[model samples]
Target: MADPSNELLASALSGEGQPSVVQLHGEESPQRCAELRWLYPAIKWWKALRLRGEEDLNGIDAYAASVDALLLDAWSPKQLGGTGHRLDPAWLERLEMRICRDLPWWLAGGISAEWVPTLVHQVSPFGLDASSRLEHSPGVKDLRRVEALVQAVRVNSGNRG
Candidate 1:
């Protein structure tokens, strides 16, 4: 969960290339999304929640109502992020698209350059997180890998659109 404080968020938002979305995780409540939206109407909010099983589906509506987008990360009881394992695509298969038709959603976990096209064709998520796959090691990104992944996403996105 990357819950940066408002001051921190303001600092980053002031920098070059203001991000279109900022994701909140863990103890960061959806109220923060409302606060941020009030403060900076230009950016959108994405709240990352861990998905375990069917029972967790109960709160999907409330969650979706609070943010512009949802980021479903694989549930790992022992960890916070980057489990290096993809959530079963079948998990998404059960969802009714009409439920969240207005809200965009994203997927996370072990996504790779090669998986982008297939995934885009399948779920057509609003976006994806490719950090773990683009890294040479934890916290250290490989520039070449990042570039290749970006190229792959662009090509695949064009194909999907």
Candidate 2:
């Protein structure tokens, strides 16, 4: 939360092809999000939160109100991220589309080419995250599946407008 971490974020901000958005995918609270927003006003913060069950439904608004966007991912007892497990679609469904009006959000975890169309149309997230499952080994990705995922999103997004 100090120099080394922020220096990394700052370098990304100032480096070539600087990213317009960055993600904070930890156990940071809404107050922390607000603080970071103040610290780096130019950065678009996407706060990633894992959904454990139906009981967490109400807490979505707090995160949404705090950040530029929200990324709701599948929860696992062991992993912090990249669990390759999915949350119940019904849980995400209750978030409603209205939230996207002010701040776009994303869905992550266990997403694949097959579910892309349904997820794009039904859940209607601002974006999706596909990792873990796309990898053949720890860090080695199977490009074919990545292409398939991209193609699916393209096909489904075109249907939107």
Candidate 3:
């Protein structure tokens, strides 16, 4: 849905829903996230930052504090999302040192269940955001695959600890 209406957002947040975090993607600004927080106080807000290259990270460290969490996705310079592109691991590494340590974050864009353990070891993010990887098609999540992925991550995390 394109920028949810305040009433709709409030209704969704107030319903009998599982505990969830609200992640806003598609070039959402900090101000937009702030407005979402004001409209739906119950849901945690994450701002998606699309990094096209290293230079795009310039002032992100300073901007990250206001967000509950940051979501790093591959920048397509042309599209909105689900471009099936992977972000540079080196750029992600630098970003981890710069922005993620102090706050909760998730890495999106072309992530798969197989990548979970390595990503957890490398970034130690609060979670992973799997869209296309868990989907049979855009907007259609494969429940079985998603469940398997959850189980795998739990097993892996337990082993690590």
Q: Among these predicted structures, which one has the highest TM-score? A: 2
Q: Which stretches of candidate 2 lie over 4 Å from their true place?
A: 1-19, 97-100, 158-161
Ranking 1 against 3 by lDDT, winner:
1
Of 2 and 3, the candidate ahead on TM-score is 2
- 128-156 in candidate 3: lDDT tens per residue? 77788888888899998798778768867
Query: Model 2, 1-161: lDDT tens per residue?
Result: 22226567667677578666778877888888877778778778788888888677676677765699988888887876788898777677777643546778788998898888777666778788889888889878899989999998888884532
Tens digits of per-residue lDDT for model 1 on 21-94?
77777756657666777888888888887778755555576756668888878888788778767777656655
Off by over 4 Å in 3: 1-22, 31-43, 158-161
Candidate 3 CA-lDDT value = 0.71
Top lDDT model? 2
Number of backbone collisions per candidate, in order?
A: 0, 0, 0
C-alpha lDDT score of every prediction, in listed order: 0.75, 0.77, 0.71
| Candidate 1: C-alpha lDDT | 0.75
Identify the runs in model 1 with alpha carbons over 4 angstroms from their true place.
Answer: 1-21, 27-43, 96-98, 158-161
**Consecutive 10-residue window with the lowest summed lDDT within model 2:** 1-10
State the TM-score for model 2.
Answer: 0.82
